[model samples]
Target: MGLDDIKRRIAAAEERAGRAPGSVTLIAVSKVQPEGRVTAVLDAGHRVFGENYVQEAQGKWPDWRNRWPGVELHMIGPLQSNKAKAAVDLFDAIHTLDRMTLARKLAQQADQQGRSPHLFIQVNTGDEPQKAGILADELPVFLSSCHDLGLSPSGLMCIPPEGHDPLPHFRLLRRLAHDHGLPHLSMGMSADFESAIAEGATHVRVGSAIFGDRA
Candidate 1:
């Protein structure tokens, strides 16, 4: 299966939920995936691909831009402060803006380049220590600080831990998006995306379901 099959499957998922098909953006998580596969998806008209590593993106994005200039790229992994500048130069959006320091770095770097990619504030939906997201309770304060920098966050993103019922977790992200006036909710992935769609995930990152176990 590939991007075409993923599109049809997502359409079916939406139809099952009584939602109109094509309402959600399918962010193909291409982390550690071959650049050839990314091109194949782009060739199939699936333009948005998500990359988790800056190094992988560094190689793939330039070639992608040379090939499919209209394609969109999103950084869907934890972003470290040292690599913020590289991310600013490459990705069209970063989905893991969880700390004030990193947000500031991104803003400054984006300003240096005279461009601001779409941004997402990742929240720890399950409050997992190992996750790279602001805690639900800490969001308001964090947002206020980010607001001082005049960065209008585009949305909230999260990844619920495995084995948890994802509906409630997805709902929490939706609520966080709405309460914060965010228009996008980046939730779900290959495994629980259907449940996520039912709970109002505006963006679902699909990988194995599309590329089939790149590992």
Candidate 2:
């Protein structure tokens, strides 16, 4: 899909929600897509992108960033603690901070590198058995633990269970962020982004809608 189409969708969603224009950040999820496709997106003037794995991102984004300094990379997958340093080194933001051990590791990496990527606490709003996130009720204590470890996250992030209406989950995430005095809400994906925006998503990670089916 074209960038214009994505922008239009965003505009329509924001309008429906009565949110001011540009209130949300569109993270074109480029995970598993080829380098040429990513290059095409950059050539089309899109900057922010999300990747599912740190190693996959390392293969292409470093050179791309050198050529286009305006680019911003976001790590939107389950990050392993061992890869925390590499992730902290490359990504401009991290959207899957789900555990205290990872938080502490990221904090250490950030301090050592002298740069800390913006963090989003991933909450398993749906309470799914297979998902990687802090359980909804554990969010408060987890957020507090992150703070104690000096990993002050920007907001919350979640992926509602597949095949379910995501509106309620999005709304809950927004409320959680608000109650915690957080400013950013990174909920929503290609399928339910509109609903997420209507509820109050500050960032939407879209993949298939923008890049077509992954090859």
Each candidate's TM vs. the true structure?
A: 0.94, 0.97
Determine which window of 10 residues in candidate 2 has minimal summed lDDT: 33-42
Instruction: Give residue 48's error in model 2 in angstroms.
Output: 0.3
In terms of TM-score, how similar is model 2 to the real structure?
0.97
lDDT of 2 by residue, 1-215 (tens): 66779999999989888999999899999999877887888998999999999999999888889998799999999999999999999999999999889999999998899999999999999899899999989988998888887888998999998899888899889899999999999988888888888888999999988888899
Residue ranges of candidate 1 with Cα displaced over 4 Å: none
Q: State the local distance difference test value for candidate 2.
A: 0.91
lDDT of 1 by residue, 114-210 (tens): 8888999999999898878999999999888888887778899988988988888899998888898898889999888878888787889999888
- Range of the 10 consecutive residues with the lowest summed lDDT in candidate 1: 33-42
